[model samples]
Target: MELTFLVYDVIIQVYAMLIRVSSLFNPKARLWVNGRKGWRQSLKNKVPAGGVDIWMHCASLGEFEQGRPVLEALRSLYPEKCILLTFFSPSGYTVRKDYPIVNHVCYLPLDSRKNARIFLQTIKPKLVIFVKYEFWFHFIREISKQQIPLLLISALFRPGQLFFRSYGKVFKQSLLSYNRIFVQDKNSLDLLKNTGIEECVIAGDTRFDRVLTVMEQSKEIRAIDTFLQGKSAWVAGSTWPPDEQVIRGCSDLISKWIIAPHEIKEDHLLYIEKLFGEKTVRYSILKDAPEKFTDKTILLIDNVGMLSSLYRYGQAAYIGGGFGSGIHNILEAGVYGIPVVFGPKFQKFKEAKDLIYLQGAFSITLENELKDVIVRLGNDLFSKSAGDICAHYVHEHAGATEKIIRFIQEKRFLTN
Candidate 1:
């Protein structure tokens, strides 16, 4: 415990300095928002105090989406309970700043003993939920010490995973504190047994359930509607710079394309503009640009909060960040019934391999291969074959949410 505190102290100082120098406002400013009544008062705008408080913690934006169904269930089942969400990253916090379900959203401070205590004290949650892979020892210890229930949702584990391995004693022991663990796959169950912590259930991934919900609610874009009046559209979602470079290499004579980067920055927009300078790049939301896209390339996605929805507008899809070891959610594309394409390096993502073996998704090792695949998809011989197979693959794997929601409700955690 002392060693952990020492490590945390050393880490938080550097974090504080980073926050000071960085451009964005620190979302965890509330943790240090004590002693100054005005600042403390402003940082933590008042939240409902008397309701059954349920606090959910996520590592980032993806996990937040994974936790959405559970959040929705709680809201529907116990409307009186005040839901609070804390994100460990700016991406999640910024993306979900206006999420309808959560009353209070803020950054989980760099976990130190003092910050942990203050956070738990303020939220005073009846239950604490950790989505997927955020296993903070101090946070869990504080929740356990406060005699509140802690749950892990949609979790996965493997044989060589540190928790089950010989050296994972301390981390494994820390997990024993949770009242229950709801894992996504059976492999996780097998791994947990090796640790002798058998109080877990195969609850499946809630993200599938969430993504299905997204598919059900997905809206077609007006600009895409105009662009794809006749031609089949290839959509790219959450791509990075390398992904954009590959997209730009595609010939302008192809049917039509929508390129949505994972980021929508001024410099990124400029880089994309430089690449597609002659072709038209539409600002998705603004839509006030020139009228050259009828025979041109649509380069930049100046819009925010709409990439997931835009995947619904394509016959073929390419998810971003594959080139830089960051695989965006292929399942988002999968759910839309589109044959997905991505870069070669996707070993860390099990779904990528699953999609590849299922005989529809393509993993290209070279940019030329990407060009070849695009050209092939344009050909009349093999378009619908892969598209139908991809759709079938996603259709068969859609019940991860039902498993998780049933577990949470049965345990009576969200019940007021």
Candidate 2:
């Protein structure tokens, strides 16, 4: 265990050095390096003194979305408490730093013993919450030593994960620091229990709650509506290069397509334009000129923060990223009652599996399979039925945030 901690500490320091080196040329890496430059001092200055401070740590944008509902709910429930949000990734911090709900949003300092001590001591949180799978050993150990209320929400665990492995004893010890863990499924709960840690609840995923909030707040975008123009449109969101190939292969099957590629880099945008040709209009170009897209068959999204609302204009949707590492959010489209399609490598996502079982989503491994699914969903009855199933599945799993809030209330953790 001692040797493991030493090796892990060295690896973390090496990673920090790598990020600093990469920041010289990489724009995103530069943001990451600059973001944490004076985090401790900045946090000290911004965080108010002498109040119940609740801190939430998220890995990135997705985890922030997963934790947003609980954060908002906590704000409403305890108006007097200070809400501190920290992100380990630049993606989350850059996008949500100005998020109105939290008092402050900043990049978390690197996980070292000294950094952890300074962060916790300066922030002096009454309670600490970790979103999804973030388990920083140094932070956890310090917070545990202080006996602060530490909770992990929207957590999921699989049997083959490290915590269940033979050499995971040291890693498993980190789980002991959490006061309570609210997991996503029964399998997660059982997995933790089997490891002899039982302070958990099967409260489902809070992302359902977040997506529900999105559905409520969604508004009409005139240009997007005009682009659709009452036609059955297929919206493909967060598509990688591989996913774009799948879309290109089936382009002939659909007359109207809206694609939002994962990266909006110049090279990527040019590639999409070259593939789709003159018929494709970049979203940045058409937000003010909806009439420009009248002759265009594909409206290529070159911006961010609009994909969720755009799903409302689709008959069916293809969620990207499945062709690579993992699938992006399917619930964003699913909540809008649209049948979703993704690549076959979506087994790790519980919602994808559940949606597949409920007939709300389809996973296609090949280009031909995607074309066939598109054709099948073109039928009005089949489309509506699948759409209904998608929406219903989201609605059914909508109360994890409430359940978590209720648990917090029962524990009397909120300050008066």
Tens-place lDDT per residue, model 2, 1-416, is 88988888999999999999999999989998998888877877887766337999999999999999999999998886788899999989988999999888888999998999988888888889999899899999999998889999999998788889998899899998888999999999999998989788888899999888898999999998888778778999999988998899898788789999888988999999898788889988988989767778999998888899989989999999988999999999999999999997898899999889988899999999998999999899999999999999999998999988888888887654
CA lDDT, every model vs. true structure: 0.74, 0.90
Off by over 4 Å in 1: 1-45, 158-162, 165-167, 284-293, 379-381
Candidate 1: tens digits of C-alpha lDDT, residues 1-416: 46645665787678766755553464444323321225234335655545337889998888998888888877887777788887777677777867888777766776667767876776788888899998887788888899888889888777776677675666687788888888877778878876788788887777677777888998866665665666777888888888878887884645667778777778887787787676656565335432435556564577787777877877789888788976788877777777889987787776678778876788886778888888777764476677777767666666766665676678777565
How good is model 2 by TM-score?
0.96
Off by over 4 Å in 2: none
- lDDT assessment of candidate 1: 0.74
My TM-score estimates for the predictions, one after another, are 0.87, 0.96
Best by lDDT: 2
